[model samples]
Target: MSKLFRAVIMGPPGSGKGTISERIAQSFGLKHLSSGDFVRENIAAKTEAGVQAKTYIKKGLLVPDLVMTRLLLPRLEEMTKYSWLLDGFPRTLAQAEALNSACDLDVAINLNIPLETLKERLRHRWIHPPSGRVYNMCFNPPRIQGIDDITGEPLIQQEDDRPEALVARLRHYKDVAKPVIDFYKAKGILYTFSDTETDQIWPNISTLLSTKIPTIQSDARCASTH
Candidate 1:
């Protein structure tokens, strides 16, 4: 069997982690496991950890590290047969440590976009609330400015996406992420990509993964023959 690859992508909001993660998953045939989506799925299913998580969430409290690890680690254990890319978990040093105890990570991809760049990107972002469709005025603008393409409803900029709020959020992310980055760096698995645009950074990530990921197709063929 080909060696299983495990990776996590980290970035502040507007740093293009989602787009980059999507590309990595598609290009490498790794399952993309989003922590946010997983939490939501568990909550919808009302699993034990999910039920615990809901109480904190209902109180507008961040779920404790223990609950997060309990919710995440089991799902990861189930994917032993497949390479995977994880996103949006381990927002703090404590969570990172919990994850470290659970499994060894092969890579920690960090996006270090400039504050100004992030601000510009986020400032232009708008969303259609009803359908949860997002549009970037700079790139993927709707057919009509300030209007949802499908419903023609007016789009709204999230309060958190505003410049002042974004600055505070981004600062908080940097403060929270530094220790995690250092932890991965010390482990020699952290790869940081810095650029103003996702397009510019993607080629470098693709090259890195090409060298890192083993050829799974041949392994699959060999298994089939046996």
Candidate 2:
């Protein structure tokens, strides 16, 4: 049987975990599995799981862990034939352990960014709702302030992106995320990169995956034969 690579990623908001995950998945030939996308897809399909999740979502409550686990496990089981990377699930130790029982993870990368930096980046964020385009005042600002660059539509700030709500969310994430990190650390598969910029994080993630996933490291070898 061919080798299968499985991994997970964890980071606080605005730490560029999503960006890094995409790059790593592309480079490593790994399936990029996202819990948010899974939830959205299930809700759209209106499956049994979707119905259960929608009730909590409509009420602004978190979907129960067992429901999330049921949704995620089957997907992961199906992907055992290919390398895969998980993003934005297993927010707590119980979830991590449950996933481990399903499939052993090869590595887990944690992007470490200072809380101040996260707060600053999140504070300046604005979104064009129609297109789901995000702009930041600090870095990539719209051509005209308060308007999107493409459609000239007004941008709205997400409720979670507001200063007070962002702080509270960060605190909650910290409280829940620590034990998950600790659980992975105890397994000796967790690698951490302290990076403030996505550019910095990408190189490290690429290098790490090249070391862990042979297909990524052997791309040049395979290319040479053609």
Candidate 3:
């Protein structure tokens, strides 16, 4: 069997982490595990940790780090047999430490988009909340302006996406993410890609993974055969 590869992608909102993560999962044949989706699933299923998390979420409070670790670590344990890419967990230094204690990470991909570019992209963004479909006016606009393509429903911009709110959010993200980035950097597994567009960054990430994945997998395969 090939060696299992584990990675995490980190970026502020509007940095295209979702799109990049999806592409990485598709290109590398790694399972994409989204922390947000997993939390929602557990909440829907009424798991103990999820029930505890939902209480904090309902009170407009961030879930405690212990709850988050409890919710996330077991999910990682289950993915032991396959390579996987984790997205949207470990938003703080405490959580990062919890994750460090749980498993060794092979890579930590960081997106370093310019502030102006992130603002521009987010300002033109709209969403169909019911279906969770996102549309960007500058690039991937709907067929009719301000309308959902399939449902023709009027789209709404999230208040959090507004420039005023975005600045504060980005500031918070930078503060929270710095320690985690430093932690990974110290481990020599952090790769940061800076660009105005996701397309420009994709090729570089693809090249890095192509080199890293095959070499490790081949070595593991050779050892297994012996």
- Cα lDDT over the full model 1: 0.86
> 1-226, model 1: which lDDT tens digit per residue?
5667889999998888767888899998999888877777788889999899989867645688889999999998899888889988888899999888878888899999999998998899898765556688986899999999999899998777788888888878889899999999999999999999989999999998887775544565578788
The 10 consecutive residues of candidate 3 with the worst lDDT sum are 56-65
Ordered by TM-score, highest first, the candidates read 3, 2, 1
Error of 2 at 218 (Å): 9.7
lDDT of 2 at 133: 60
Q: Which number leads on lDDT? A: 3
Candidate 3 segments exceeding 4 Å error = 55-61, 128-133, 142-156
What number of clashing residue pairs does each candidate have, in the order they appear?
Answer: 0, 0, 0
RMSD of each: 3.9, 4.6, 2.6
For candidate 3, what is the TM-score? Answer: 0.87
Off by over 4 Å in 1: 46-48, 51-62, 126-135, 141-157, 215-226
- Residues 49-163 of candidate 2: C-alpha lDDT, one tens digit per residue: 8889989877645678889888878888788778888888887777888898998888999989988888888888887765556678877799999999999889998767776
Model 2 off-target regions past 4 Å? Answer: 58-60, 124-157, 215-226
